[model samples]
Target chain A: MKIGYLGPKGTFTEEAAIKLKKFEKCKLLSFDSIVEVLDAVDKNKIDKGVVPIENSIEGSVGITLDLLAFEYNLCIYREIIIPINHCLITNKGVKLSDIEVICSHPHSLAQCRKFIEKLGLKIRSFQSTAAAAKFIKGKLNYAAIAPKRAAKLYNLHVIQENIQDYKNNFTRFIVVAKRDHEFTGDDKTSIVFSLEDKPGRLYEVLKEFAKRNINLTKIESRPLKLGLGRYIFFLDFEGHRKENKIVDVLDAVSKKTHFMKILGSYPISKIYESNSLKK
Target chain B: MKIGYLGPKGTFTEEAAIKLKKFEKCKLLSFDSIVEVLDAVDKNKIDKGVVPIENSIEGSVGITLDLLAFEYNLCIYREIIIPINHCLITNKGVKLSDIEVICSHPHSLAQCRKFIEKLGLKIRSFQSTAAAAKFIKGKLNYAAIAPKRAAKLYNLHVIQENIQDYKNNFTRFIVVAKRDHEFTGDDKTSIVFSLEDKPGRLYEVLKEFAKRNINLTKIESRPLKLGLGRYIFFLDFEGHRKENKIVDVLDAVSKKTHFMKILGSYPISKIYESNSLKK
Candidate 1:
């Protein structure tokens, strides 16, 4: 098996991918962007792809969500939730005062805002936190906010561990494949749909799930990109798409919606409970 | 009167500020961050502050939403929706082949992904699109994806205009003040609340508005940042908070929510119709 992820390596996505039991013996490949990872899966360059869908502090990863909704004909096969512990890394012997610039992915930088502000250092954004660590590995007077594993991979020293403003920072990653997963007892059905321009359209749609007591885990609206106030609703509900209740809800919703697409039905991820970095 | 905006000048926020008739004679102040802009308004350093609340393509500005929900005591006085047109700016005599790096705010870069991908240029993120233009003002080989006004403001030439992937891209900016505005009958009330974790909790919240036939323009869920799956919902509905129906809904929602905050009720923004880059 071959699995692709967003990386130059040492990213949290890679960490999550490695934790999956099925991919223990699989060859892992890294792509620069989430789009590329999904494309690889679609093109069969890789058997599956792992990309971040949401961050606890940063909310949804829009690019990932958008690609799943419109660009790729892919389905989420599984999910992995990893605790995000951002570490401040720098070249050996580089002290706090020597660091003039800190670089990381924008989300990581934002999560570590308090630490960055306290240091009064300038911020630069890189494609990914691991990429920032790789760039700053042998450099002096530059630091990176990256996963702790990045420090070791990039031969940098951890100047500070768990530097994010919030201690419970976590990112949820989803494995995407060309086909949807078979129904598990505990699963999530993700769907995207657009409603007609009318009052109470969304309420009517939500009522389908509510009346059936089918709980929704998440609901997000993205602009349809046609114009202002035009939106496409993305929803995650607590059931597999094949389930009778879910099928009925989708059938009812489809009749009311202008357009609807089922992204996938996948088993919900178990949260990472270990505080230690090792799995 | 003085208006604070996210700027080092030539930002879309400044354009929105200038369009406001009431701020015609007001001195405009530029702050480096959204937090600073809101802080200035809270401390009376500026009478009002203009900040981007959402982009039609990019969705909600999470920082702005989070601040309104937890940090500041300010209310949204009005909203401004501006069409976002991205321009590729470069030094005079520089050709596309000479461009090595493209810089802009992350959102601007993402909006122009198709154009940038075609060019295959390296991307660098700045604090704002205007700042990227300002930084690349006299530099050779570096181009910026910024508002057309920034090209003129920074003495750079527009290599390309309307470079955003979507032609109808727009950003919604909110004017936050220390107090709320009087209802204009055509007003929007924005509120944030967290429901008790249970099945049908959000459904219950929406029923309150639906039963009254109140229309919700937007609904977004952001993680409370404490952990995954714990979310605070931000809702925008078509009624002023002062209305009897709205007041009753709030009373009912308050009882169901673990926490609740009324950001404000303000007149909805009139979309800027002219496309000539002039107010």
Candidate 2:
């Protein structure tokens, strides 16, 4: 069961893909875009594909959500939450003061803004954290804020480890499989829906979840692109669609919502606790 | 007065600052980073600064929101909403088929992924939309997807216009000034706060706004970095705190919330409904 994911290698996605030891001896194929990863899964180019759905620092990956909305048949099989640790890496013997320009993925750089400001270095953005390490390897007098694995992969030296401005950083990744596997009974369903442009419409939808006592973990809206007043909501609730209550909630919600799609209800990851360690 | 914004002279911020000309004699200052714009505002380096707060296409500009929360004490004095119109551009005499590699700001590139894939070119990322336009000026083999203004500013010809996959694309920007101004009466307040991590904590805080019928425009959570489970919620609501009802709502929220800071409240920009066209 070979798997494809977003990568040029050494990205957090690659890390998450490798952790899936169930498919041992399976080849790992990396693609440049999340859409490509999804297409690969849809076409059976890869048995599974992994993409970051949310980050503790960045919130939901809008493209991932957009992809979910656009691609109708793909099912989410499993979810993985990976702890993100960023490091400041540079060419050997490069001192902080000697550096005038720092390059990294924008999110990584943002995570260490205070440290960069304290050092007074200019920042240049790269496409990915691993790509930043690659940029540093080809240049001198620059540092990259990236994962330590990136430093190792790109043959750079770590100037500082765990340089993320905040501790307990993590990114949530969802595994896209061709079809939904048997549920483990304890699973969460993720859905996206759009409400008509009217007051109390959204409240009424949420009222269903609340009245049923179905705990909602998240609710986010994106522009439906129709106009200023229109929006689509993405909701995550702690129950499997296979459950009777969830089925009723979806059935009622389907009638009220202008557009609704159940993205998937996969077995919750084994790691349920939010393990953010305080420094 | 000169208002510097994050831009290459023709990005959305540039467009918004130009639209603000009726309210003030505005000179546009383009900076590479929003933090730089914030720093300039803090040092009185510029009379005002406009930067993107959120985008319908890409979601929240997390770095901008983060800077508002932690690094700067600037107040939002005005708001500007710009409709996003992406165009594919290249040097004169260049055709789409002539391009082998494409470059743009990541979000821009991502927005135009469908078109780029249909054309089947390698897409590279640059720091900003304008920078990509500038880079393509001397490079014959690369084209860029950027805002319409960027193509005009950099003297590049548009290969294709309005190429975004979604028709309902818009970005909201805020004009930041050093001192807080009197509320416009018809205004909005933005604040960032953290709550003790637990299930339903977010729902409880949002309940405050929902109960008051305050109509929150946006609510997003960023890791607080205090620990793994903690989060800071950034909220945009319909009314200013200077109003008695809003003040009471805020007071009630502050008591129940662990940490809170009111970033600013000023007149929500009427830019969305204006007749002003991009010059």
Top candidate by lDDT: 1
Worst 10 residues of 2 chain A by lDDT: A270-279
CA deviation > 4 Å runs, candidate 1: A21-24, A273-279, B21-24, B273-279
lDDT of 1 by residue, B1-279 (tens): 889999978888887877775435788888999988999999988999999998988788889998898789899999999888788999999998999999999988888887888889889999999989999977898999988788778788998888898877889999999988898989999999998877778878888888888888888888898888788998998989999999999999899889999999999888874243564
- The residue-level lDDT of candidate 1 at A165 comes to 87
Q: B1-279 in candidate 2: lDDT tens per residue?
A: 879999877676777777888788767888878888999999988999989887776677878887888778888888888778888889999977799998888878777778888989987777788888888897889998887777777888987878987776777888899765586778888888876545555556666776878877666666565433355778778888789889988998897788899888878765463222344
Candidate 2 structure quality by residue, lDDT tens digits, A1-279: 788988978787877777675446678899987888998898877898999887776666788888888654788888887778777889988887778888887667777888888888888877688887898785778888877777778888888877777766787888898776466678889889987765456766777786788877666666676645466888888888888999999999998899898888987665433222210
| Cα deviation of B217, candidate 2, in Å | 3.5
Q: List the residue pairs that clash in candidate 1.
A: none
* Per-model TM-score versus the true fold: 0.96, 0.88
C-alpha RMSD (angstroms) for model 1: 1.9
